[model samples]
Target chain A: MSDVKKFMYVNRKAPYGTIYALESLEVVLISAAFDQDVSLAFVDDGVYQIMKGTKTDGIGMKNFSPVYNALGDYDITKLYVEQESLDERGLTLDDLMDIKYEDEDDDWAEKPSIKVVSRKEMADVMDQQDVLMSF
Target chain B: MKLSVLVNEGPYQHQASDSALLFTKAALEKGHEIFRVFFYHDGVNNGTRFTVPPQDDRNLQESWTALQAEHELDLVVCIAAAQRRGILDENEAERQGKDGNNIAPGFRISGLGQLVEAGIESDRLVVFGD
Candidate 1:
């Protein structure tokens, strides 16, 4: 486990228009079993993937938004959201789903996983990663 | 340095597969060790042996197969993605009750864990995609 590499899944596409988001999520789920230091970054249209109240009934596609809530259980608590992308898209943190994780180091206290950061901070996050897979 | 390559786009429709192949070739030429080449998403299409591009145009699958044959490269096609895209090996074809398999030579169907392992073991995990 000491060899855990920093794996970042960069999401820059919309949820359903293309298969990128779904496929990227699939990889993330599979990666959870590896016990690596994994993180998910939401930028551009990818921000919509975690948006609150995403209903797919009319679109005839499976709504995978709820899966974000389960990521914390998979030991993937780092969900970095780009503020610039949300701002450009006229969205705010309130528009996103509330994803929280239980902090075992803090007496199992529940903590929010989504972290809104400026573009500069997002760049730093990308720079600190050992592996970057953009979808 | 040890490196791993991830190709997320299909052949012909996008330049990702070609870029990854060229990059891997160049890296090997420079004396770098390629740990593995993982094909995911539409990239699994690159492992299909049914592709027959125009005679004048370069056949990407054949190119990858030839390079793999020469270098003994570990070419992996993601099983989930391959199933979705219909790129199956002989074993998978039988397991899935399919009548045929079209996976190109030197390519093996595997899970996404192979990609995660590649990332963890390789010095650099270069992803070529949109």
Candidate 2:
């Protein structure tokens, strides 16, 4: 009913081990329909949610990793990854899936959505959000 | 302040449900408006009418039901997550052709959009999860 509110979905748990990661994505996808200013913050083991080559065949779980690719189409693009979390996990930006969004304002130019930020920067992002949904 | 709460864990297995209930009660006592309380993931279990805890232990479902009645709260369980975990309401039971539905009083099965709407409408959205 009101103007758009800044929503940040803070993810901290590992994917698959718990249902948090997938369920958080479900809420993220649904939030797109509300025309809110939404962004995602991946810290701790949550960084694993976007890792490339996620194989769940032996585990017999639905590999929902591919669903992250469809996020760009939902008009939800900002994904802030904490640099410290990646370093502690021995992961690099290259380890993540290449999620891109087509910028409508720039003649539909493709741009990478995942922005690697320092812990301090991530804190600032969280500080500015009107609503924070943690998982 | 207007607030919305999201619960992401089951009743007895985790403390999230209890914490959320206490937090909601505290907020209500302080004269704050609770826009909605959205249940997701294993949190949908809190809406089951058949949960029978020990006599000494708190009946979380009934507690939540009573709270909702007192405050006129909007207690919503995510429909997709509920269906996956077998938490069907009357309409859902008939739609899915299930034999029974176990949704407790004062809680309704709805869409994930309700969660988003809660986030947008509330002054603060407090999440109770792992």
Residue lDDT tens for model 1, A48-128: 999998899999999988899999999999999999999999999999999999999999999999999999999999999
Task: Please give the lDDT score at residue A82 for candidate 2.
Answer: 99
Error of 2 at B51 (Å): 0.7
Q: Residue-wise lDDT of candidate 2 within B41-81, one digit each (tens)?
A: 99999999999999999999999999999989999999999
Task: For candidate 2, give the lDDT of residue A40.
Answer: 97
For residue B32, model 1's alpha carbon misses the true position, in angstroms, by: 0.9
Interface RMSD of each: 1.5, 0.9
* Candidate 1 CAPRI grade: medium
- In angstroms, give how far residue A40 of model 2 lies from its true place: 0.5
TM-scores for every predicted model: 0.97, 0.97
**Chain A TM-score by candidate, in order:** 0.97, 0.98
